[model samples]
Target: MKTLGVIAGREMRLALRNRSILITAAIFAIWFPVMSAFGVVAGAGGDAATIAGGIAAITIPVGIFMGYIFCADAFLREKRDGTIETLLCTPVSLRRLWEGKAIGVAVPAYVMTLISATVTIAAISTIAGITVVTEPLLLLHLATIVPVWIVASAGLIGAAQLALGMRENQILGFLLIFGFIFIIIGLQEVAPGGPGISPVTEGILAVAGIALVAFARFTAGRVTRERIVLTIP
Candidate 1:
């Protein structure tokens, strides 16, 4: 656990030192949530909670996708800088190191997502002269689903980055970005039809979230030190 903390701290420091990454993260983290909030409040002619829940269902994925962008360089940057080899030699096991790296990015992204959502809610309330969102489910999402989803995504992306060569990494990065774009588009198509928050849907998402984390853990285990070391140019 302590080893994981050290590894996580190192990743956070790296993220802080990269001005471009920080700026990009700031833009995406702030922009998407605010837009989603205002759009839902203005357009959705329904209960505030229901509208917020619908907005959240679609927008939360945007938050996770933004988190992925911030973490896209999680392993690629290390490999490019020639530090991954040295980091691999540290006392931490491969699984712990990878999980920590993902967690490090996930923690900050999740916090920013929460802050962005809260600020939007407050803004809507102030402007509309009514509480725009009082959804317990939206609260539940920010509390549980968002964090787990971010961590799982970062962990999987990190593991894949460590395992792939530079050319492959670049190709996949583009694919992942476009993939998220399509997902956002798809969400927009369905949201207008008014997706209900059935208990079954929530259950499926919870199960999927847990499965994603487990898949990440399994992938981390497969990211051998030698494979990563050899992949370094």
Candidate 2:
């Protein structure tokens, strides 16, 4: 437990040192709401709810991007640099290392989203004034999206590392992330009133995304003939 926490903190520090994470979070933090506000003010876009919804839409891809960048690096960097083996030489277990790496990546991505979302919400609330009202339940529902993205990304990146060996896995992560958002949009458009409209849908999408990533990672882990046979037994 202590080791995982220490590893997690180290990961967080490493992420903070990286400029891309900061830049990505900052750009979206400023970009989405500003664009939404401009559209609202100029009669060019949507009301507050629409603006909020648009912001939510942007968040899905942004979440994926953050997850891919952070989690992919977390899962692959150790293997690529040979640090993972060195860590294994210590008393720390593989599961701890994996969980710690996931935490390291997830903590930053989650925090960045919280910051970005807060800024977006604040900006929208201030500018639009009384034009649009936000429901508490809606805000709560939206807040859950960040953690979901984090878990999904961790699973995807881990799987990519195990399955594609990192080198060939890059494009798939990007595609999967965007592809997810596209699917979400398409589903919403086609079946807005479908049974998939509940919080259950949210749970399913999140679980499915993370589960797919896990499957990829697990598949990679069991690629060896010995491991495959062991599972069968």
Q: What are the per-residue Cα lDDT tens digits for candidate 2 across 21-123? A: 5787678756765665555444424455455454555555566666677875576666666565567667876556666777788777777666666665666
Pairs in steric clash, model 1: none
Error of 2 at 112 (Å): 0.9
Q: Over all chains combined, what TM-score does candidate 2 have?
A: 0.72
- The number of the candidate with the highest TM-score is 1
Candidate 2 RMSD to the real structure: 5.5
* Model 2, C-alpha of 88: deviation from truth (Å): 3.4
Which runs in model 1 stand beyond 4 Å of their true positions? Answer: 123-132, 177-198
lDDT of 1: 0.70
- Model 2 clashing residue pairs (backbone): 159-217
Report lDDT (CA) for all predictions. 0.70, 0.61
> What tens-digit string does per-residue lDDT give for candidate 1 at 42-74?
765546765665556654575566567667656
